[model samples]
Target chain A: MPTKINIRIVTGVILLTVQVLMVIYARFDEARYFCWAPHDSQNEYAIFATVNDQTLTPDQIQKRYRIKQKGIDPRAIQHIKDIIERYETTYGKDSPAEVIMHYSTNGIEKPSWRWPKT
Target chain B: MSVNPLKIVNNEMEPQLLLTAKAVVLGLICGKYFFKLSDHFLPVWPIFDYLGPPHVFEAVLKVLFIFGCAGILFNCRVRLCCIILGLVFLITPLSSMVSYRNAKVFTGFLLFMIGLHKKGEVPWLVQAQVIILYLGAGINKLFEPDWQTGQYFEHWMHNIIKNPYYINATMLLPPMMLSKIMCWLTIAVEFIFPITLWRRFHVSFFLWTGVLFHGMALILSGDDFGVFSIAVLCSYFSFVKWPELIRVSFNGDNLLHRIAKGIVNVFGFDNHFVWQEQAGGPLVATINSQTHTGTLAFKKMVLYLPIFYLAVAVLISLAPTAALKSKCALLLYVLIFPLPEVIGYLKRKREKA
Candidate 1:
């Protein structure tokens, strides 16, 4: 018969083996779980808004309205565009969010900040 | 002679040690209720949107999650209740978010795992997971050009923060100098955090440094990071040796003993429960009363640490400095935790002398 310590040891082994296996499986089965090997600080999206040279206060530009997109998704442009328009209409159309932000830690990499021509 | 950490054992205090860990999780979860209620950070996720469980049912799931976690904390079919809690988390919209997934999903899994090990000490797996989190964070930070150079950190502090006292403090030096120092320190501490596993004292030291870093950072700069900091700090509760925990419960003069006595009174049990030891014999707690004269097998699980921890969480919850005070409480234990080892070493020296 297994003693209490033995039972605990077995349980720990089983759980650990299964979790490690899950991480391995995540490599192949993307849907089962997300990436196991975390992306080191690769893609960063900094939140910034400005009028020419003067940066806008974080209060004026709602931090909640800030968009953090993952990877090379083109839809990121649209999201940022929406936030800018929302900020303009609500706060001031004349004081549009001018600066392009480039801060991201959502485990996505290699994205550029490009301004959409108005 | 070097101490072997694995040789340390006190099977009798296993449950309460784990229960204390549960109390931290429960407290953090309860603290999170306000944020969730106000719908502060719930972003619409594309994954949960299409995979369904729709955003509308969040309130119902929150209620279910609270009760489920409460049931688990109370130790009623803990594993089953934890699974119910996990399912709620898995289906929640925010669960798909990277931050939420990293925090809640991993933590829920840990709770379920620890529940399974209730009869034993906190499992080796939970300890490894914490090591992995720090190592992962450190490794992740290492490659970041901004973390290496401190440029991003400076920009973040100077631009992102609104009205934090620490911002002024950081200005005592060149903006880049402080950021650069902090950036590197974070990486170094996290990378080496896993080494604490080799010894008990090392674990406390490592955890204390982490608490100080997080606690001081939060207190000086109100950076909406209290949740993550407290959740991680609670992980250290698992590493607390069972013998020390039992000693705290038995020593009638200490706060833990008084708390234990208070708990006994609440259950209508005699508050005179005392731990008695004899030469070359097992330790035992004697329960002597008018009608009942009994010796508890010192069997740990049939005992508990929930009430003690809940009482602490409640005290912190009521305090105006909940964040800072609770952080101090955790930080205070860092010094307190090493007393047993310090005392033991001195006793051995005295005998040798």
Candidate 2:
């Protein structure tokens, strides 16, 4: 017969283990977002991929991102901004900083056109 | 001296106890397939990319085919039905692998155990599968960095309370603390799941905690994970001493007690006659009660009656609109099925507390 004490102890340990695993999973593992991108974005679909990439419409981006959007870590947003700035500086192409700024402030907006052909 | 036919027939019911097991296993399998059909093919809302040319026509056809085959087997021999039920264990994991291996593996174990009910033996294969599942999930979670630091829980909670359904003013507390608490709580629950199953710790706390934790996840995220959590609680069935509750139930007020006891006894019951109680006597009694009688009867009825009646009701309700054929029926099935039980469970718990 299973004693209540035994159940309690087992429960405690298992609870701890799950909590720990969840934290580790959230931090280290790549977040799984169900969204659309230009097929090369490693299956990630941010609400605005680099803000002004005309090929990726805001509607498409928002649709993909909106499907599974959760709370974004404040620090994670900074990380995104840092990566974009670095990429723009390295490429030396007149960067879409203003577009990036627009998305960062306004969130994603819907586009008037249909989804890009998959 | 003449032997009473009733007495002889009563004697025969003992050997036929396994029939009950066959019925339950068959019932659950049919229930699941029926449920899937409604959810996948005839949903009220078009799932994701539904209107775009049926993306999973093959998968949909396979389910229909299996549902048809299972229906035939259910009407045939019990022993043969059970063997075929056992074979279903193979198909679940294979199909799951085509989707996501992790989900498949987890689902496979649940299916395997539920299938084991056909013979009334808690096979070693099932026990091992359960242990491996919990251990594997626990280990994987342990190694993840976000999980280790507790940020996952923190992130989850901050967004969780913001969902319109779960919004509460009390959630204005610091996210860091919530995150840490959630992180530890998940690990602690997973680590001890197997231990509690093995009798190293009491399982009720773990099971109840899991219900709360997972319940929170479901409510906040609108995820169906709460169903899986409830199924996991069934794993601790061996440890649940359900008889105490029934015994206590009968102890209050003489008039009520007699009425309850008389009803059970009149039905020619063993321990299995009482809901949620384990049989204390006879191999047949234990197996039969769990499978053929009492709570098992309720379970079987819950699975079969809902699908059968709802199918008829749907057909009638949708007769005017032949185009809606199964779609309208499916909506009614999903919406109405859990109402009584969900309300009952909550009411019972409230009364007890």
For residues B1-353, write the lDDT of model 2, one tens digit per residue. 11211110121111122222222333344334323321122221234225334446435544543643353234333333333443343333232211211222233344333333333333433344445456545655565556676655443544432443222422555645555666667677666776776664645456555545544544444433312332333333333332211221233334534454455554432233443322342111232133323333333333322133323322323244423433443443454344444566697799999
DockQ for all candidate structures vs. native: 0.12, 0.04
- Least accurate 10 contiguous residues by lDDT in model 2 chain B: B4-13
Which CAPRI quality tier does the interface of model 1 achieve?
incorrect
What lDDT tens digits, residue by residue, belong to model 2 across residues A1-118? 8645644234334533553454355444433111000000111124334335454465643332222222233222322333343333432245332222222211223232111212
- Clashes (N, CA, C under 3 Å) per candidate: 7, 41
**lDDT tens digits, residue span B99-119, model 1:** 233445455555545545544
Instruction: Give the range of the ten consecutive residues with the poorest summed lDDT in model 1 chain B.
Output: B1-10
Highest lDDT scorer? 1
lDDT of 2: 0.36
Residue B249 deviation, candidate 1, in Å? 12
- After superposing candidate 1, which stretches have Cα over 4 Å from the reference? A1-118, B1-21, B34-60, B90-95, B98-102, B116-118, B156-175, B198-201, B223-226, B244-353
